[model samples]
Structures are given as structure tokens and as C-alpha cells.
Target: MNFKGLFRHFTDMKHYFVVVLVVFAISFYLGWANSDRYSFFLEGQLQGLKSVSQSLSAKGNPQIWYFIFIFLNNAVKSVLIIFLGLFFGVLPLYMLVANGMILGYVLSLQTNESTLSVVLKGILPHGIIEIPVILIACAYGLKVGMLVWKMGGQLFLPVERRTARRELANVFRLSKTLIVAIVALLLLAAIIESTLTYWLVHL
Candidate 1:
């Protein structure tokens, strides 16, 4: 559905995507470097995630359950952040930072196996797609936030107001395509994570 339009829209917002990537990278680095200092906090978060995983596993057909859980979890959050980004992009940015930090912290933890091996087997498989989808979603969300900010500033200028409104409408139109892409890719990633990544990690 209007694939060319979606591509152009994304190209226009490339800077926003770059901003999201930079923020996540910095947060991840901080999490990794300060893992020891933030151990207790990160541990609590991991425990909550562990509990959710255990509960899902208990429902039987663990792989199916995991796939459903992961898909729905990511889909809902990714979509929600897009709209919630109306709040000056604060929520989406915070989400990026939090997720990046959590991933980094988890990876920083010592294990019987090497970190590279863990990443190659457990994360790279699904993350290669999933991470970029998440980042793109956040970029769109950030764009929404910035547009809202611009709309506010243009309120007194009738000409600028019209321009901003038109741009915002275009964003909403293109966003439908982006959301569909994100959901579909995340679904595939969930399947890979639940089956391929799980198998490789266990091996």
C-alpha cells in the first residue's frame, strides 16, 4: 500500500532514526559499562521478565506460547509508542533507552559461554530484524512528537500552521504502512526467537 510513499517518508525522517539509534547506543554502552553498579536494579527487571517467561511456559506448548507472547508484547508496545509519542516524544525515547539498557545489561552478565557466542546464537538471529523494526517505530513516533511540537509553535502563524497540518496528515497516512511493516517483521522475529534462537541457545 503506497510503498513508494512510505519509503520517501522514511527517507525524509532519516535524521530522527539516527537520533534514536544514537540514544539507544549511548544507553546500551552505559548499561554495559555500569553493569556492576546497576546490578540490583537490572536483576529485578530480569526477574520480572523471567517470571513472565516461566508463566508462559507453564501454559504448555512453550514455543507457541513464547511466540504469541513475544509477538503481542512487541506489537502492542510498538503501536502504543507511536501514538503516545504525541507527548513530545518522551515516552518513545524513554522506551528506547530502557530497552537498550536492559539488553546491554543482560549481555554484560558473566556466563559459562562467551558473549560473542551468545549474541551470535541467541540475539543475532531475530535481533537483526526486530531491532531495526523497533528503531524505525521509535523514529516514526519521534516524528509525530516533533510535528506536534511544530504545530504548537505554528499556531500563531496561519501559513506555517497550514503547512504543519498538511505534513502531519501525510505522516499519519504513511504511518499506516510503517505500522504494518513493523507488525509483520516483529511477528517473523518472534517466530525465529521462539524456535531457531531458542534451539541454538539451548544447544
Candidate 2:
């Protein structure tokens, strides 16, 4: 997608960005505060992460295989968030919380300076794209949930067939844009993370 299109989408849906930011902050605080108490949980989580990375490294060139692995993983996840939003937006919210918490916990395991370095060198390179794409997916998913609710409410109205059809069409149109943007953003993020971020962090 062009920069203008992406910019317009972001500007048009500022509220969703705020929602994601708020959720991430809350989850981060919780993860930081409970890091010690949840040490075992974090250990298990780290192990799982390690295995995934290790598998990528085992391949001849981590950058290529890693990009594919991460792209597929993130694309599936983001798409699920968008589609699963139909369940009263619970799934998207849950995903944001879970991901934010995991990130917070992982960062908290290091010293403040180390955490800053990690975020700067490892995460930021791709996070600028990846995080926003995730938020957009969640936002669209939440919108779908709202549309479903509105449709449900409209069902009780005396003459709502046409209105309901219009709303459904709108949801479908918006969803198409969301899916396209999410896939494109995730693909770029995977490439940057697997190459640029990896190189920076290793350096």
C-alpha cells in the first residue's frame, strides 16, 4: 500500500491506536510488577521463544527462513485477531494483553540499559511496523464486533433488512483493507527483523 493510504487509514482510526496503546501499557505494567512472582512462567515462555529462534538459526541462512517463519506466524496471528473480533472483540483484546505482557516480561528480565538496548536494536527496527499492524488488525476486529452488535440490535427493528445489508457490506469492505494492510506490513516487518534487527542486535 502507498504511504498516503496507510496514513489516511491511521488518521481515520486514531481511537483504535489509543486503545492498543492503553492496553499495552496496562499489560506492560502488570508484567513488570509480577516478573519475579512469575519467574517460572517467564522461563517457560523464554524456552519456547528460544526453540523457535534456534530452529531458524539451524537453517542455512537464518534471514531467509526466519523471514518466512515469522511472516507466516504473524500473518496468521494478525488475521485471527481481525476475524476473531466477532466474538465481542474479546479475542483481539486477549491477544493484545498476552503479547504486551510477554514483551514486558521479556524486557523486564534484563537491566534497564539492556532493556533499552534490546528495544532499540532488536525490537524497534521491525516493531514500528509490526506493532501498528497488530493494532490495526485488532481495531478492525473490534469494528467487526461492533458491526455484529449493531446488526443484532437492528434485527429487532421493524424494517432493518436493507440497513443490515448495508452494514454488512461496509464491514466486508473495511475488512478487506485491514487484511491487505496487515499482510503487507507483516511481510516487511519480518524481513527487517530477520535481517536488520538481527544484525544490529548481534553487533
- Number of backbone collisions per candidate: 0, 0
TM-score of each: 0.95, 0.85
Off by over 4 Å in 1: 159-161
Superposition error at 10 for model 1 (Å): 1.5
lDDT of 1 at 188: 97
lDDT of 2 by residue, 1-203 (tens): 24455556667567877887898889878777888877686678678879999998998988898889899999999998877977978888888887777788888877746778889997999999998788778877776677777778887777746375575565565666667878988999998998899899788
What digit string (tens of lDDT, one per residue) describes model 1 on residues 104-191? Answer: 9988884878889989998999999999999888888888888889888888886844576788888888778878888999999999
Which stretches of model 2 miss by more than 4 angstroms?
1-12, 37-45, 161-165
Error of 2 at 125 (Å): 0.8
Model 2 worst lDDT run, 10 consecutive residues = 1-10
* Candidate with the greatest TM-score versus the true structure: 1
